[model samples]
Target: MEVAPQLRPRAGLEVVAGDVGEAVPSYAQAFQVVVNIEVKPVATVPRRTPGASEEADRLWLEHARTAAVIDDEGCFLVRGADRDWVRVRRTAHTALSAALVPGAGSMVIAMSPDGRRLCALTEEDDDYWIVVHHFEDPLM
Candidate 1:
């Protein structure tokens, strides 16, 4: 699948820590890649709840340095440090896609204090996987 142009890493930036798994070979790690990355855990909402994605987004706007909204169809709309939002579409079979399915477990949204990174934690079958995206610049 093609990743949104905005989601691509900027020049001089690389995946310094995480393993780019079979999925897309970019920033595809199932676990958090900690490299002196400090984040504030904002909220955890049950995915089974109605409008869970919306709730996540709302919390993100209030607490995140950056935030991403993942729809059930595997579409990602990410807001960077600039407060500008960009979008990407992913295949439906990915772990994130599965976790967004109705009746799935909870999702936790976290962000760096500097507003340069955003982490989304999704639960699947009692297992939680974290996907982190980093921005080249800090929040304006």
Candidate 2:
């Protein structure tokens, strides 16, 4: 995949605005696929921070729920029990509503087990970024 000129490794969290697709795999290599289920699209807003995604991965997963998989089309998908799917979808929607920028598009979303930290992969003008959102309080 061609990297967008504007997208470069930065110090803190990286942020973006818009839809993202197709490029997630390269960045999500360390994430193991937990399941594969069809997910409905939810409205998303583009927001970002400047930090190492690897760092977020470690911190987020230290207490994260099973990660939700976003497809090339930006829809959520998981391969697991019905309850797991429901939880992931619910968490995705709640996270989007609470933390995202408020726009029409799809993004990769992973929630902490406690439903507080949200890690989203978003794209804009062909450039992709990973943004992490930490809610002062839990969403549950």
Candidate 3:
């Protein structure tokens, strides 16, 4: 019997866009993958007044979604869901959408090249992780 060498992913390259609406190139050059993030400003909070003077407004992102493509190797996409993905910073207010709640089906962490395996990132104990998943029936 013979065994093949193991392969692992290199540290992914980073891309920064000036705005959330900018287009990201689909071609994978000099990198194993490419990623972009989308964020929306949902709230404005006032910081603690210094010396009882004027306070500054801090913007908060209520929703954030990230998309990634690994050329022909694979792809990844995920969104921050549940309770608007953020709370009012330094405030006791929480925003819960009555119409658009994040659900399990809307999340797509990653997909295998052969389309056999799926991956997802889950939060546990304030830590995030990649969890590979298998489907009972492979989609066509």
Taken over the whole model, the C-alpha lDDT of each candidate is 0.38, 0.31, 0.22
Compose the digit string of candidate 3's lDDT tens values, residues 13-119.
12211121112221121012211122111222222224211111111111111211222322222221321011111112211111111232111233333333333
Query: Candidate 1 — worst ten consecutive residues by lDDT sum?
Result: 11-20
Give the alpha carbon lDDT tens digit for every residue of 75-119 in model 1: 443323342333333332222322243345444333333334556
The per-candidate count of clashes, in order, stands at: 0, 12, 0
Arrange candidates, best lDDT first. Answer: 1, 2, 3
Q: What TM-score number comes out for model 1?
A: 0.31
Model 3 / residue 47 / CA error / Å: 26
Q: Considering TM-score, where higher is better, how would the candidates rank from best to worst?
A: 1, 2, 3
With candidate 3 superimposed using the best TM-score fit, by how many Å does residue 56's alpha carbon deviate from the native?
34
TM-score of each: 0.31, 0.29, 0.24
Report residue 100 deviation for candidate 3 (angstroms).
Answer: 19
Worst 10 residues of 3 by lDDT: 1-10
TM-score leader:
1
Better by TM-score, candidate 3 or 2:
2
- Model 3 clashing residue pairs (backbone): none
The segments of candidate 3 whose C-alpha lies over 4 angstroms from its true place after superposition are: 1-108
Q: How does model 2 score by TM-score? A: 0.29
